[model samples]
Target: MKQIFTFLILGLGVCSGVQAQVDAVQKLDAVILSDSKLKNYAAGIKIEKLTDSVLSNNATSLTNLLAFNSNIYFKENGAGMVSSPSFRGTTASQTAVIWNGININSQLNGQTDFNTVNTSNYSSIDIRSGGGSVQYGSGSIGGSIHLNNDLKFSNHAETRIKTGYGSFNSKNLGINSSFGSEAWTANIGVDYVDSDNDYKYLGTDSVNENGEFHNLNMNVNLGVFISDKDILKLYHQSYIGERNFSGTLVGPSRSKYEDENFRSMLEWSRIIGKFSSRLKVVHLHEMFKYFENKDKDNYSLGKVNTLLINHSFNVSFNEKLQFKTILEYSNSKGNGDSFKEPVRNVFSTTALLNHKPNNSISYGVNLRQDFTTGGERPFVFSVDAGFDLFEHYQIQINGSKNYRIPTFNDLYWQPGGNLDLVPESSYQIDLGQNFNYPNFNVKLNGYYINTEDMIQWQPNSTGLWSPINIGEVASYGAEVEVKSHYNINEHQFNVSGHYSYTVSEDLETNKQLIYVPFHKGNLALAYNYKAVTVFYQHMFNGDVFTTADNLEGRFTSLNGYDVGNIGCNYTFFKNTKNELETGITLKNIFNEVYENVAFRPMPNRNFNIQINYKF
Candidate 1:
């Protein structure tokens, strides 16, 4: 703890310097896609934007990038197997993942596995904290994560290639290229990663057996200017991966899982006078096969297909008032060995109004309603306001109602499926304050959420587990973030950090939720001197209870841990036409022994080297 404080003090006490400009590596010319809605309509929401430099530094996987940079907590079966997130103390299913303005959560499980997503494939990533059901739809009770691609229209062309070799025989390869003209634009990215993942378990002679895995991701985006007032865009993404589940300390097992995902969307936009409109057609497909034995051909298979149509219109009444409306329809079909085939159809409508009465005050109102064939639907609404209290201080507040419907596996599974389950509903409120200066920025936020009829799978009288409407739950938390950058001559320094305190309790038992930590934080520091850059990052996770009863035994809870990483990079052969850069990262420099999940030990100290070339 003392060392951590000393490091922070050193970063603050250095010679004062002028504020640094935005990194030259950022693609400032690109136009943001779906996130424009959030920026325009969500006046009081808290949004975090991951910069291009951060994305390039942690290009291996989304799990690695978020765990060190965001306030969300993650639990991994092992180093790179079956990772899930707990945002603001909410369950994994309560967090929504959006891709290209569409909700892409699994229809079978209602959640996304973070390990399967590659960070290098997307042009931008944004994290929105607080309930977002009014604009983003279901499974957004806690928060939402957005992955987007940007479109550029200019006479520009570039290509980048990167390769890396890491510990445990891990390898990474990535290629990205983009070209833009007066009439059209194209961007494509491909990434492949694999590992033998056989690290030795700390404090034990056993090794992480059967943990090898590999994944491939490909993304392509195209845009065409149809006319002076019309534009068309197309996006497609594919992901395929296979992994062997790691064995726990208690036993060894041979099991494998294979999955594939494909997504495509086409959109058209037009503007005339004060009115603008957009229409989108989307298709998504996901499939998975699980093998209990590595050598066996027999496996349980699941597949789902979804099609959606969405249209939205926006009109500006004046410079201070705006109105927007959206209508959407979706149909999904699921078939699997564990559950009977099922089909679901849903239709929804949303209305939004924004008013900026003056320069110091702004507010927005959003309302949505849904009708579904599977079960009853809920009406959700959100209200937000922002106030510029002074020159350097601002206050914001927001409240919303959110909901999540039951998944296919919850209602159609062979023996234990229950058809009577209802959607889970939640109400939440957030208060925030911000301080911005020339060189430093700070933000503080507090939030509370109450959920009714929470869904949980539990054993019944016949010892068969089935989904049921659990009681109520209450979750509250506070977050703090600080960032600053300074430049003196050719030397530059950047510092950023965030801390979260959370408490989630079950109304009946009055106990903390399992895997929900009470405190978590991380800090990052970087120094850039001409062609060389050095960086360090540290993360701290408080103890977490693994059991619902909040037991104190070693097998029931995990101890707190602190981990640090350091790296440096150098740029050479830099010129107007080409550039080459090489870097090395040492992860877990202190060799901290920790486990995200009980009985599942993480890897020890490791290192990786990467080289990148651009033209």
Candidate 2:
């Protein structure tokens, strides 16, 4: 027995040493990749991957791995071009989201709407919580989300096609393919969905009139590995969709909109003798059209076309300290009659330093400067520290000062919109801790944020939603999560859960911020035996308040609800040359009727089936 124990310990040591060597040679901060690159290295990544299943629908429309861990609240406005996510007490434009290391917010004027993205095209999706100003500029006040295509499976030439039908007359069709050699890879994907969401309405004679949505998405990637340490990638993605706006009017007219977003990325990375370099050029164009009534009258341009250019560099001079620098320049233009602004430009630079004096502790500091040709913007700065105690315990401390300028809609929006709006300034602090044992992981994060000059469109007695620079608002939040993975022979079990509570109040006036949830939680469990896997989940949303006034086109209703999902998977030929996986998903398993979004009531129980064949 003593000899066996000693041998096991020695084997573990050898494995650990090999893993450490592999980690040391890789870039620690950022990686340039397409979907093919992502899939080939998914398991070893620090990020998470949320999927509906193999070649099928995900939990919803978005892969949205961030939904599992971040403190962000967003409801899909499926019927319109504008999708908003509320972070802390800030608006949708405050948060930043990226794709393949590109700043999407800069190109879209600070909104990464989820309604249009097809989750099936992505290999990985991740969100970095709180103040990524060091690596990205502008819309990083709340946090940053990064997503990319998967490339690992591109080594072989394969094609996948999936189609499904469900409640509300929803239809979906998707196809994806990848081909590659030892030195080059290519991937292509196309997906389309059309849904007439005429679910059972509550207390109203008319069925929810305008809840129809149609979506189309495409993604393609080509890459070449020039050498062991040099790589170049070209990626293109686009989403074109039309949504039936949720907010309704008493007349026959229903809110509707069309959105087209397209992006191309050219990225190159090369490593030379203890130093590495990266460069990326991004081109994006978007068109947003909103119309009321079937005649397509009352057309309004929600978002105009825009372009962005971004770059970054990172170097590890020695073992103790590393350096990173980033720059971004963006130009925006609005055409069509609804918008008056011609064009705008913004640029920023940020520098960051990460130092680890010892193995147990590390500190990071970052400073940023920004320039906008049209407006006077404030500089952004932040600092963060991470401490590892006793190998399995960690603590992170962070603080940051951030600012946001008025969007085009907020500036010249006429009538209900404010023109003379100043940029909102905010300061925030966060404390986070996590502990991992051989079988379990526990994580907790507590944070506080204060904002002055919050911008909101509060209606006067006249019932108009007018932009107002409100007084300071304070918010404090806490989240706790735990996960465990256990294995016995060929049987396995996984369990995870998280809970978060948040509140925002006016500092002087003592009023609650609008439409911000105070509580959220998710629970998941999976059991595996032989070739079969069973998984179950429960997602809960706490109460949030919005305007009860019927006159307001936005925020006419809000509430809280809980939903559950159950799934099972079967793997055939698990150990053979042909591998196959099949699974099913049941959303809203309890048939609970709830509404987290106004006019956009929750969908009833839905079912999905998925299959995957591995080469």
Candidate 3:
């Protein structure tokens, strides 16, 4: 399609999959919540063998809590929808979100936005910020979000059902059921959602453009306990969507787009006294089709398939000694009628050590290497440590040497894009402190990243933009978060907020990076009574943006606020064998109009209600 050999001259080797997650198995470094490290802990964030379903009615959005005072430098585009989730001045794609343990992102291609992912399917989501390579894997120069899910459990039956409708014609319906027995456990669930999102803009005759989003998700997990020391599982998940992206509520009828993805995993684990081993194989397929306009008459579509397999081991000799190792392999085939025949393989390995020398201190470090058949073969490494000082005080320090290989899209995004790009490499460091007191908690963190071979859509003297790696970048930022949870008789309340600020600049030209906010964050206060809760959400933004230089001073930013949400739940029936639950959600309660992202207009206040019964 486009000259595909440009980056080949620099990166060519038998690349591998991600290395293993090596952590101390010794009692000293062993961290457990509830029971069963792989089962319960996984439900919280670990990702391998989790517990509950996150999409249940009792669950909330991933950003629900973090949005309050957490984003510093978030930019809102003209049309309104929070353009995408950017962190510390980075674009959406810069922040990698992993579903399960594998990365679903299209390399540096930057296709799917963070918002495209509904945290609804996960049992819990873990966020690792600031070049956290050791904890995650590669492409984490910015940060990472990991989604944990529940595997099929035995001898239990549970069903979840919910329905809700709120402002701007938004509504959701979900039903999921799970069954487990001694020999096998099976789980199946489905979700349906539709939204007619429309919000008014400030100082404009045009209401923010709106997009109707329709989504469907299906997943199944089957597992068997082969023996007292061994277990095997099969996991399958799929998602489909029809999205409108014209930055308008009602555009050309044919303008909406569609996306479909499916994934399957087979895993086995064995335990013997102080040693354990695990193996997993995965297969994934994805397709994306979009229109140049709503007409749907003409569209450009693409598809990709990936097969990845991984193995790892852990051993503990005593309360202080532990060892771990991992290896993986992957093959990706990208073929689209309108694209190229991109094929490649990767290999990876990692080693780590974790120590809790005392009750007041804990730390860890790791070494990693990645090799790809037709891509860059970079050796990366990371180290981190967290200390609980004295009492109620925590301090964390982390750093990493990581690289992000350029994706095919960066060099081949069509007509005028460049295909001759170099991979980006960076070094990052972060330090943070936290204090927890009975009912109050506070956390403060500072981070910095220095990058070489930075990716850019540079404008040429002729005024056209082309992807290039001819620049360097430096990013520095700080975040402060505070939370208070207290109960007054029948009333309970949680007040939480965060303040984030980032300054990112190009080292080569001394200019600000594109589409990054200089300051952003949110504040939320929720009050609850028996079966009732009311929430007040406020989001704030500071000045910063990106656009054609021709509109130097024409850009508009948020120095504004948006009020969101109000809801209540009611229990109509309760018995040992039967129960009924109902609730409602009011979004944008005050009807205040605002946008968190550029070009995406969120609906004004809305309402939703749900009812559930058990037999």
Candidate 4:
């Protein structure tokens, strides 16, 4: 795999030198934006929007686009190493990752490494599921993932490029650009990935030793209008990663890891007459390094920094009332070789209300409060409702209260830190149903959760390990979704799918909960026949136990699998400016002998090839 055919022949010689600067610009077709504060206060919460052709067909990572399109489970330790996520059955520090409206997790380990993100640097990707910490603060209890940036003004300009080559010697590159005027606007994204993941081990013959990895990502967005009621915004993101720590079919290793992240934000908005205002400022940075012996240069370091401020106000009061208010502040600092006191501060306030007295019905209410320097200060709330029972039916309901605090190595780890830990609470509820026709759509949901003081790190009586407030947990779930679209004349069709059923428990040893997966599902299909397209995807997972007492022999458990993938694409140089596309894919197909983590072996039957250019 020596540099994978010289980076696929230097990415086809830089796509033939940008195809001679492809002019006559006008090819921007990718849109699906929302997050006007969760579409105006999140009435019955169940968001799941991921488009832009499913983020350019999962342009690799956000854990391969939410484990092949969302019912989230992922535990990965190989094949790009370390990825985590479990949402709905919670834990990965209770899932939350939002950007472009703050809360970027990890103040020294609250979580968020979905393989260092990079889903082609985002331009909208949302997934909201149960409880959201009264609008994203501390680990939004089992749900929350949004990353957005969309701006538009008037005239336009564009550029796009992508390249890929795959299977064990993987490679990728991407670039995007945008421009607009009338006031101003901008967007940019960049991505790069590499892998030499080694692969092999299905029934064992070794290989996959020091699994390699690489990453880089960048994103930026800007906007300005500043006059007929002022507006301004800016955002930036960056990430860098490195990896090598895979070796477990009976060991032979040399650990290594490195990480870096940065984020910045600024915003302002205004309008007066019935009030509408917003202001935000944010900054975040994280760092990490570790090396047990990658030729021994010795390593161990950690760092964290955060600063934030936010303000919001909105009002309507008529045509069916509305209101919003928020204020927030934060400061965090951490340093490490296993901390021993590193600063924290927080303050928060929020309130929201919405009502609709027409078109069947709607409702929302949310509240939050927190103030901390030391531990628990929480008070949160949420209530949601919606209904419209005919002409395609709908109904929804929600409830919430969520919290999580204590990180910085669980409050200053030094031989086992834990100076009185508290703050882990949860309570949740959700129920929903929806149906629509004309081209079909359906959704259904059910949920429940209860948790309290549930933190654990065990080992006492002189065996060090700290962090307490143990035991008590429960989770329940159900979800189903389906979607469809069709056309007959030039032929186009699409379909989508999802399913999940979970049960996470520990209520005093009632078992289950280590890697928790009680079934999961996915499916996708597409067909278009004018410029050619074809696609397919499938996934399923079940049976995961690995010891929290639900164990069963041989390495404890992990046995359930189904995987598939297929692809096609074509669209040669077309009109109205420029375009070129080509594609190929075939992953796992039927060569599946899986492991989500037991001994970590996955990947067989693989392929990929892609190229795209636009202007």
Candidate 5:
């Protein structure tokens, strides 16, 4: 506790220092993604942006980056294993993942594995909290994560290469290159990662064997400016991964997983008078294979393919009133050993209106409807308002309706498939406030979500599992964040912290939900002098119940744990067009023993060193 206070005091001193000598430090232009409807219409939404420096610190995977800095909780089975995120006390399937303006959640399970996404492949990441189904489509009852790739036209060519080594025989290598002119731009990036993951188990002498994985990723982007009124952009990404799944201490040890993912998107934008229009086409394919043992004959294969076409138009009437309309068409097909061959078609439309009477106040309203040939049809809507009360203080209120459709596994499983399950729906409300200053920013938000007719797989009297829409849940949470940064002479200091409290319950049984923590907190501080920098971060997760009934005298309760990490970076060389940097990170400084998921132990203290060069 004393260390935390001292840290805050040091940051406060920097924030209170004189600003006359701060002209030497320049802030980079933040990449503000325009794909979010909330960002364009509302003023005080709960949105967070991860900058380039932060991304560089944790470039291995998106799971590692978000688990430490964000309020979302990630459940991991083991090192280099499958990982998923739970947002705002909602289940994993309720959160949506959008890549380059298209939904990329798996058609089989309705969720994306964060461990499979490489953070180094994208230039920008944005997280928008609260329900966003009105604009982003279904499966957004909690929030949405948006990943973007950019192609900027510049006169100079640049190249970057990095290599790193860590504990458990882990290796990382990456390369990125970009060069373009005013009329055309292009970017290419590639990354490779492999790990043995043979760490020792806590309180035991036995080592976790057969826990190895390898991953490769590639991304390409091109942009063309066809006159001043029109532009076109194309993007492609591919991923290949193979991993050995480590079962429990007493379970099988030879299971393996292999997967391949490919995505392509093309977007065209035009401007005419006060109207702006954009058209996008996307295609995605995923292939997965599972092996029960080392035997080549014992395996299963699954495949899913999806295509999307979307069009959007925005018109501004003067500066106080604006209107936007969007249309989306999608088709999906899947085939697997346990699933029946299924095809689905969907069409959705949305209309939104924004009103800003003055600079201090703003409001927005939107209505959306979705039509599906093989699924439930529903209507969604949202309303939000914001008011600037003072020079740096603001208040915001939002309400929305959201829903999620059953996945392919839930509807088309071979043994107990149920094609009559309807969609799960929810109503959400959010209230928030913000305080912003040159060197300080603070935000507080509270949200309540009431869900009805949730789909769940339950065994009948005959012991056949089937998905049924017979569950209700009520989830509410509060989030608070504070950040400060200052540049004093040649030294810079930054501090950021957040805390969240959530309570999720089963409406019928009045019991807490499983795997949802009640309290979570994070703190981070960084200092930079000249070309050298140092940082430290700490995270805390509260106790969680692993069973829905909250029964005691069982092994279904998980105790909370604390984790701390410290790192330092230094510039080795710098020139007109060349630079080199070296960094080292020490994670789990305390060597804490804990499990995020039942019976899945995490790694202990480990260190990694990285070297990067750019020319």
Candidate 6:
């Protein structure tokens, strides 16, 4: 270990010689896609943007991308395995995942597995924290995450290749290329990763075996400039993977899983008079296979297919007022070993009005209605306003009504299915304040949410669990974020931190909700000198309860823990149009023994190093 550290240091030091001869590399140009329709109508909303740097990091999956914000928490069984995220104090099903302007939640469970999402597939990511059902459809009571690929029309061609080696015999490789002509552009990307995640745990002296995974992803994008006012774009992506499940210390089970997913979309936009219109068609297919070596009866297989057609138009009425309307239609079908075959069709319409009467004030209102083939109809609305009090101070507020429909599993699972279940609905509000300075920025936001007709599974007189809609919850939270930057000659420094406090309680029993943390915080510092950059990050998670009763302190309790990480990057070679870069990251510097999910132990200290070349 000591020799490896010495070699890494020597390698970085040898590359420093080029700092004196090379000029600073220019930043990549930001690509603008037509998918910014939702962002343009939002006021007093908190949105976090994750660039390529945050997406393509040492972390194994998308879980790490959401963890960068203290307000969102991801519960993972372990590295390279199943993971889910909770926003504010809402459940995983309440958080929506939007891929290229379309909701991609599973029809079976109404949830998206973070482990199956590869960050290398997308060029940009955006997270909106609050209810967004007014613009999006159901299953957005908590928040929404958007992954988009930008279609860049450039004059030059570029290619990049990246590879990484890490602990537990982990390996990753990716290739991306783009070429453009006068009126046509094309881009393609491919990524592959495999890992033998047999890391040791605290309770067991021997390393946990049967923890392996393999993944592959490919994407293609094509864009055509139909004149100067009209554009057409097409995208396609596919993912295939297999994983072995690693059970907890108390009970170990031998099982393996396989998954295949494919998605495609076509979009066309045109500018007519003062109105801009866009039309999109999307298709998604997913399949999963589960095998239990010891018990074949417990094995299962399932698949789902979905198609969507959507259209929207934005009209700029002068510069102070704008109106946008959207119409969407969706069809979904699910089939499985135990699930009853079900097909659902849904249609929705939305209208938004925005007004910016003055330079310091802006406001927006939204109204939407959804109709489903099952005869379930829902109506939602939102209102938001923003005020710039002074040059350095600003205030904003927003309120919305949201809803989440029952999943196929909740309504069609053999013995536990309940066809009489109703949709869950929520009312939420948010208030925020911001202070900006030349070198620093500070933001604080507080929110409250109340939900009714919540669904849960409970055992009946027959001693079998069945879905029921007899639950209610009240959730509230506050978040704070601060950022600062400094520069001295050739050296640059950046500091940022965030803290959150949340409370969720059941209205019936007045008991604290399970799995929701009351406190979370993060702090990070970064320094850049010439061609080298270094960063240190720290995180703290409050204790969580596995059961609503909070049983024994050692049994049902998941104690809080603190973790630290340090990393560095170096640009070894650079020219006008080409560059070579390498970096290393060390996680859990102190080797803390902790678990995000009860009974599931996380790995100890780990290290990963990556290299990239672009030309």
Best candidate per TM-score, number?
A: 1
Residue pair clashes in candidate 4: none
lDDT of 1 by residue, 203-279 (tens): 99888999999999999999987776667899999999999999999999799999999999999876565566678
The positional error of residue 314 in candidate 6, measured at the CA in angstroms, is 1.2
Per-residue lDDT of candidate 4, residues 275-374 (tens digit): 5556788889899898988788889888888898887666666767787767778888888887844989997777778898888888888877777887
lDDT of 1: 0.88
lDDT of 4 at 434: 86
Among all windows of ten consecutive residues in candidate 4, which has the lowest summed lDDT? 25-34
Give the TM-scores of the predictions, in the order they appear: 0.94, 0.85, 0.84, 0.32, 0.93, 0.92
For candidate 2, lDDT tens digit of each residue in 117-209?
Answer: 676777766656665544555556666666767455234677766666667777877778888876777889888888887665544555556
Candidate 5: residue 116 Cα off by (Å)? 0.6
User: What's the lDDT for all of these models?
Assistant: 0.88, 0.66, 0.61, 0.81, 0.83, 0.81
What would the per-residue lDDT of candidate 5 be over residues 189-252, giving only the tens digit for each residue? 9999999998877876666677899999999998877766567888899999999998765564
| Highest-lDDT candidate | 1
Better of 3 and 6 by lDDT: 6
Could you tell me which 10 consecutive residues in candidate 3 have the lowest summed lDDT?
Answer: 40-49
Q: List runs of model 3 lying over 4 Å from the truth.
A: 1-83, 152-154, 181-184, 198-210, 247-254, 416-419, 461-464, 548-552, 556-560, 573-579, 596-600, 612-615
lDDT score of residue 360 within candidate 5: 88
Compare candidates 2 and 5 on TM-score and give the better one.
Answer: 5
- Could you tell me the TM-score of candidate 5? 0.93
lDDT of candidate 6 at residue 382, scale 0 to 100: 94
Please write out the lDDT profile of model 3 over residues 252-337, one tens digit for every residue. 23356787889898877655666666678989888878776776477777777889987666555555545555666788878764
The list of candidate 6 runs beyond 4 A from truth reads 1-34, 56-60, 294-299
Candidate 6 residue-wise lDDT, 1-615, digit = tens: 433533443343333233312433232222447466557887678777764555655344677666754468778887778888878888888999988888888888888888888887787788888899988788898888888888787786988888899899989998999889757788899989999998888656866567889999999998887766567889898999999888887777688888888999998876545566678999999888888863455668888888998877666667889877777889989998868588889887777889999999999998887878875688888999889999999898999999999988888888798989899999999999989899998989999999998877889998999988877899899999888889999999888788889888898888767788899888878898989989887888889988878664887879888888889999998887798999998988889888988888888889889898899
